[model samples]
Target: MEIRKSRMADLPEILKLYEEARAFMQETGNGTQWGTSYPPVEQVETDIREEKSYVCEEDGRLAGVFYFSEGPDPDYAEIYEGSWMGSGDYDVMHRVAAPGRVKGAGSFCIRWCAEHSRRDLRIDTHRNNLPMQHVLEKNGFTRCGIIYLANGEERLAFEFLPKDI
Candidate 1:
């Protein structure tokens, strides 16, 4: 499997993945996390234009998608019920998703991002998103705190600090 920057042409496939992700989350009893219209198409388009969108491919077919950007994700500016590990800079990952076809795509993307990141890496998921929480912790991320998204929803935040960087 390989992870690469996503292009506009990948939009349709990416949307499908997000739709499948919402359905999967609902099936797992985490329906409120993404709601019905999460990660709208316009946002994906902007991520593509700004070069933040990414996709994981296995044997030449798209398997997963995510958004990565350097943080203090404005929404993360004020954490509640906990605090960040440090005051240093960090990168934030968001909107990770994969269809059932990709067995390890989520973990692969998280690992790849951490290995390539220049500073501490951060990500947040809804409290009930056990799958994502597992992927983050398995790849060396530690639960840092609870943060509210811009929409006022709560999320469990995790961070991965680079060993020597």
Candidate 2:
């Protein structure tokens, strides 16, 4: 699969993928990370416009989407209860969505983010998101502890540094 910048045309597919992910989460007894109003269309549009969002294509079909950004993410600035792995520049990944067609999409996305960024990569997920936590751990992301009040809820944070490479 190849990863490329998301365009306006990919929005619909990305939305569908997120919906599928949400359904899967619900079926697995995991609370919805995006909730009912997650990933507003406007956010996707903005990410596309700013070229911070990306889509993964496998055999010419969109398989996944994610937002990669450098520097501090405003929402993640005041992590509660735990500190980040390092204090310098870092890339934060958000809104990663993958279709079932690709089993390891999250790993691919995380690897891409690590390689694309010059510094560390950090991500957070709901405490109940076991699948994501497993993926992160399998890919060498260390658990840095918990952060609260993002998207109106608490989350477990993970950080992958250059040393983890």
Clashes of each: 0, 0
Error of 2 at 82 (Å): 3.1
lDDT of 1 by residue, 125-149 (tens): 9998988888788888989889887
Q: Tell me the tens digit of each residue's lDDT in model 2 across 1-165.
A: 789999898888888888887876777667567676578889989999999999988888888899998868776677667688788988889888774758787788878887887899988888778888888899889888777654577788889998778
lDDT of 2: 0.82
lDDT (Cα, 0-100) at 115 in candidate 1? 87
Worst 10 residues of 2 by lDDT: 28-37
- TM-score for each predicted model, relative to the true structure: 0.95, 0.92
Candidate 2's TM-score reads: 0.92
Candidate 1 shows a clash count of 0
Candidate number with greatest lDDT: 1
